[model samples]
Target: MAYLRWVLGRLTAAALTMTGVSVLIFAAVRAMPGRYSDLVLGPLATTADKAEAARRFGLGGSLPEQYGHWLLNAVQGDFGISMASRTPVSAEFAARLPVTLTLTGLALALTVLVGIPLGVYTGTRGKGGGRTGRLLGSLGLSVPEFVLGSLVVFLFTRYSLGLTVGEYVPWSQDPVRSALSLLLPACVLAVFCVAAVARTTRDAVLGVLVEPHIAAAVARGASVAFIVRHHVLRNASIPVLTLTATLSAYLLGGAVIVERLFNAPGLGSFLVDGLDRRDYAVVQTGVLLAAAVFITTNLLIDLVCGLVDPRISALAGKARS
Candidate 1:
């Protein structure tokens, strides 16, 4: 019952938050300096032609009515037609989402696989681990994503050490090639992920190590591995989980530069294309989709946090009371 209540509360919050986002996006887009019609029709287009374009696109209506129409269409999953491609916004996103998802998924998986173990080791070793953790943490923090992407591309693609120009091969066309193409980009993306997660995990685990029960277990001759597996990891994982969720949200937007470097046809590339052309519908949809991903990821993190720490759920209950 408590869990159900928490779920309901989270859903309500998400719906309200999404509503606010939609309104803000709609208003901001409408408030941009030039009219949408003017963007669609180039600078050389006559005023008369702009007027006709506006009428055709139903932009002649009052702002409230236009917003209503957009809201209704959005509710039905119709994000209108892109000014540049004359294709449905949903269709463009649908086509591109999978590629971005695959890339981010691979990157995140590699991050967790490498990060968590290293974090555990570093945490267990504490200051005694020397400066290894600090050095890795510094490198991860210092390197920007685009620079990392470029470096990887140069090393693998420019060097011609078996990695060709990293064009994305469709999974259906050749899964092996597709996987191989993703490796470098994924590794670059994972650098930040690993650094952040490793640092957070180390801190969380070290904090847990000082707890009374942990000390008791340690005093009783609990093996290091057994303490880590049973006590340290389980308690430390909550923050790590939160970090992972937040990083996943960032991956959606952060992929833009990386995708461009690799010439991948993900949503990030599509977003850049939309911006270049001033394709209002495409840009709006892309931004909204990214916002949705970020919000949904955070919400999921909240739920997971509640599960991992009963005290969080209790606090929510107290607020309700």
Candidate 2:
């Protein structure tokens, strides 16, 4: 019953968060300098053309009314047509979302697979690994996504790697080729993910190692591997889980920069394209979708964390009371 209540509360919170995000995005889209009409119709367009274009866009009413209309249509899955592409915004995003998802998924998988173990190992090794981890973490954190991407491009091009070029390949046509092409970009995206997770995991693990129970186990002559497997990892994971959830937001932003740098046909590039062309429908929809994704992801992470640690549930229960 407690868990059920917790889930319901989280769901409610998610809905409200998304509603607020929609309002903010709506306002932001409206606040941009150039009119959608001006972009669609050329600069030479007359006032009559602009007025007609604005009417067609449902920009006929006050700000609140415009937002309400857009929100109503949006809830009904109607994002309207893109001014630049003349195609339905939904169709355009549906085509591009998968590419971004795949890229982010690949990067996240690598981060978890590589970062957690590295952190665990460093945590176990005491001072030496801690120092090394800190050094590497700093290096990883220092390099921004685009800079790393540019470096990758330079190295690959200068050395004639012949593995990838600045173009996207459809997975349907060549799955292996597509995967290979995205590898470098995914790696670039994963840099911060890896650094963040690894550092957090190291800290979490080290903290767990020093806990009274962990000290008791050590005093009892428990094997290092046994202690780590049975206790340390289970306890250390709570903070690491939180870090992973937080970094997921960064991953979304990084995907945009990396996609543009790599010329990948992902939603990131789609959003950039929409912004460049002043495609209001496309840009607003993309931002809202990204916001939705972040909210949903954080909600799931919260649920998982609650499942993994009873203390979180206890804290929530106490807070509610």
Candidate 3:
């Protein structure tokens, strides 16, 4: 019952969050200088051409009326036409989404493979390990993705090693080359996140190690492996899980620069192209989708946390009451 209530509450909140995000995206895009119609029809276009472009882009109506129309159609999964591409925004978005998803997936896989273990080792071991993890984390966070990607590409070409860039092949066409194409970008995307995850894990594990329950388990003839596995890891994982979800969203944002840097035609590049051309529908769709991904990831993370720790669900219910 509590879980069901929690789920309902989360769904309500998610709906509200997405609504607010959509409003912000709509307003922010419209608020930009210059006119969408002017951009689409060009300055040399006649008054009638501009008027037609305006009407087609839904810029002929007041902002609120336009928003209402767009929102209504959006709820029905009709995102309208792209002012720049002259194609259905949904179709273009659907086409571009997979490339970003594959890149994000590869990045996340790399992050988890590297971050969690380093964090665990640092947390459980001595100060040396902790310091090392922190150092690596700081360095990773400090470097910009563009610089990292550039340097990596340079070094790879110099040495004839590492993932290839400047050519992206969809898996449907050539799986091996497609996978190879994304690897470099994914690694670049995962670099700082790896550091962050390690630091978060280290802190979380250290926090759990000092709990009274941990000491109790230790003193109660618990095996080292048993205490570490049951008490240390399980308790420490909630924070790690939360960080992972947060990083997923952050990685989505990072995909833009990584994609652009490596010539990968993902949503990030799509958004860039939209902005350059003032393609309102494309911009709105891209940002709104990113917001949705973030909201959904967080909600799912909360639910998973509740399942992992009943106390979380109980606390949520009590708070609601």
Q: Which numbered prediction scores highest in lDDT against the true structure?
A: 3
* Candidate 2 lDDT over residue span 212-275, tens digit each: 9998999999999999999999899888888887777777777888898888988887888788
Two-way lDDT contest, 2 vs 3, winner: 3
Per residue, candidate 1 scores C-alpha lDDT tens digits across 1-321 of: 777787889989998998899889877776667656656776789889987876655566888887788778878898888887877889889888878988899889988998888888888896875268778988998999988888787888557677765578887798888877777777788899999888888888889989999989989999999999999887998889989988997887789988989888889999898776667677778888877887898898888888888888878877897
- TM accuracy, model 1: 0.94
TM-score for model 2? 0.95
Clashes of each: 0, 0, 0
Candidate numbers sorted by TM-score from highest down: 3, 2, 1
- Name the regions of candidate 3 deviating beyond 4 angstroms: 220-223
TM-scores, all candidates, are 0.94, 0.95, 0.95
RMSD of 2: 1.5
Q: Model 2, which residues run further than 4 Å from truth?
A: none
User: How many collisions between residues are there in candidate 3?
Assistant: 0
lDDT of 3 by residue, 179-222 (tens): 78999999999999999999999999899989999899888999
